[model samples]
Target: MAPVTSGSTRTRSTASHPGHPDLAAYRARELGRVRFRRALTLLVMTLLMPGSAQLVMGRKQVGRLAVRVWLACVGSALLLAAVGWLWPEVLFRLAADTTVLAVLRTGLTVLAIGWTLLLIDAWRLGDPLRLRQKQRLAMVGLNGTVVFAVAGSLLFASHLVAVQRDFITTMFGDGVASAAEHGRYNVLLIGGDAGDGRWGLRTDSMTVASIDEETGRTILFGLPRNMTNFPFPEGSELAAEFPDGYDCETCTLNSLATWAADHRDLFKGSETPGIDATIEGIEGITGLKINYYTLVNMEGFKSLVTAMGGLTLNVRDRIPIGVPVVDYIEPGVRRLNGFQTLWFARSRESADDYSRMARQKCVMSAMLQQLSPQTVLTKFEALADASTHLIETDLPASEVGEFTQLALRAKSQKVGTVSFVPPAINTSDPDIDKIRTMIDDAITKSEQPSGSGRKKGPGFSKSSSGASTGGSIGSLSSGYAANQSADLSKVC
Candidate 1:
């Protein structure tokens, strides 16, 4: 056959081709290949261009893929447009939301890297579509696997960053809290029933969560709202270092909040009794040192669930919800929205307050469990928005990430939960020596380094007909169910 001359296209030479007579034929063949490749590249680009897949891939009769992409783009645009039109805060929030921006930035980086690799392959192969049907199938599978892996990794990293940032910003804005003295650390986890709009709502739920780094064990001591003690920490002897302005001598432990609210001015400034004084009062009452306190005032609870795509709860009993008893729930495990879960944890009318407290712990566990990379990616904007207004923590922002990482790592470990409810103590029991002893014993066990995945502690007896069971609080190790009961009522 006669050698064909080079057509209109330009061709690059390899190291071996210097002055071959068939260079014209080679150039022509190369031009034809270039034309085919350019056509194929355009076809691939169009196939992935969100609306031309059917036409480019000769699947006009089966345009589902193209239709799907078009629908996705359309849906996304409509959703964004609706958000921009109706709830414009979503848009404004995305703009100001640092967490959202960080996620977007990381995602774009990954996409850029993948596109770069694709371009390099096209340059070397000279014909991206040169693969036979079998090879193309294999390439598709391989490329898909790699793309998913990279996307998943980037997504997980972005989520961690956002969660940590939200936790940090909510806790320690810019101020630093001086760490307390040695062997005296206080951590408070406050559960509020804010959604119900109850007037003068005392802490709906309270747990003095303490961690002894030396022993590497965590202790969560439940505190009833009604335990009689000084209202604010600074007012008691424990708060002697701080100013003592309010007097809660006759008030119950729960009513201390009321008294503190009444004497708000006395606790506002740094020199005055603020959180420090409150912590002092708790220490004096429980005889347990408190070094840190975390208060989630109603709003935080709602925002957190909303950020977490809501939560799932094991409904202990059928309960009516909403005003006028419009909504009802059957007893079983079920998922709940932010408002529903908040109400479930805070409800005291349907069941005994003790049961409500248990539900509160369940809500907390479920909330933490639901958090993952996908959830964070979807709700990053919502979380970023909620973080600014909902939470209040004393921990430094930088440390918040570390704390969350710790919690995430410990996700598989069992968490022990105990409430400070004993029939031995009642409204009439002014001397809570037995209750205090139980708390102290439990704290000691929790502080001990866990061995064999078991915490050492005393057994608890259940009170029969309001009589003290006289049993010591029970001990638990990691991986125990949240509802696991060890009858601590035996003693009194």
Candidate 2:
């Protein structure tokens, strides 16, 4: 039984066939080519349709297990997609839970590992010796790429989840909340200068943001720091201390915190006596109940603005970088750094406090308008770090999710403002009833069905000569009248 070695010796073999070289050599080469093709086909099948390669490779048990797991993962993903689409809050709640996030991160890591191993095994089964040099190199490169891409993406996602959890724990803590008042949440925003030394812990900037619980429409009421003769909340610790209203000489609105701090014994059992007393004054004047307060340190406040990559302001005048350095901020549309921005918001020595309040409101409106979700997420770490140091709040951790949802809704709507400064309604002798009526009317206007879109902030105007007339924000003019307009963007 001698084997035939040549085409002439082999039966029915064509000698001049283009498809045939030497009979035995050509047949062996053809088998090698077939093996290479099969290896590629199996690799592609496993990549796209997991477990298919194993089934074809006769690893029935491994194939069945892989197939079942793959099917379950797909089913779970589809179910989540459906729930997320229909009821997004369920997803939000689940995401907010640290335990859920931890499990998700762990599961992703494990899946990445398992998938990478399966892919490597599939590449080994491809039998690289039978492949051409180029084909073998391609297989190795492709396998390495898939492994890194999957594992790297999973690891990055897990890091983000961890960052968010850490942020939640540190910033929100375990604060106890006061009930939401009048179907709304009113948070007092205080920009305080603790280092000024003139009046201890003076809250130079104060604004009450009254947010509608359902609609998310917000009304910002600005109270001047120079405001005097305002009543305190009746029967509260502050009222008992300053019975005849806060009307002492040099007892400006900003000084209330210092007074409360100095006489903290009078506030008995209050943790942040200064803040609590300040809230009383604000509530009494606006006639809007204050639910919580966040005192932003003026020094650290610059870091926060920097973190947002600075805000754009249509600067109308040559604002001075007052105190310590007497340089001027020659104005146009300027992107200001932290120090320049703080001065722009708080500087009144150049003009007056009343005028600066309008500028502050403009800055506030700009933040609400420009601080989009995409921007925040991109600069997340910087913003998160800056915020933790800058903001001192009584807002509870549990309500953080609810407020976040509300804020997201608010972003799509125009922010309305009422500045109770100067000749509008004298803060020195403000009519409480009138203030309440103003707040009520603003709320009504904001709740209108045909909601007005955001108006451009006191836009720059030009004189007949085409020279810039400039707006009132950075100018010394009668500041924005309280309840003057439903949209502060227009009045800035």
- Per lDDT, the best of the predicted structures is 2
lDDT by residue (28-74, candidate 1, tens digit) is 67766665555456435532453243444455643454456456656
Worst 10 residues of 1 by lDDT: 467-476
TM-score, predicted candidate 2 vs. hidden true structure = 0.82
Q: What are the TM-scores, per candidate, against the unseen true structure?
A: 0.57, 0.82
Off by over 4 Å in 1: 1-30, 35-167, 177-185, 193-202, 214-216, 230-250, 268-278, 370-379, 427-432, 447-492
162 in model 2: Cα distance from truth in Å? 0.8
Per-residue alpha-carbon lDDT of model 2 for 248-298, expressed as tens digits?
Answer: 788788888888888988878887878877888888777778888878888
Quote the RMSD, in angstroms, for model 1: 14.7
Best model number under TM-score: 2
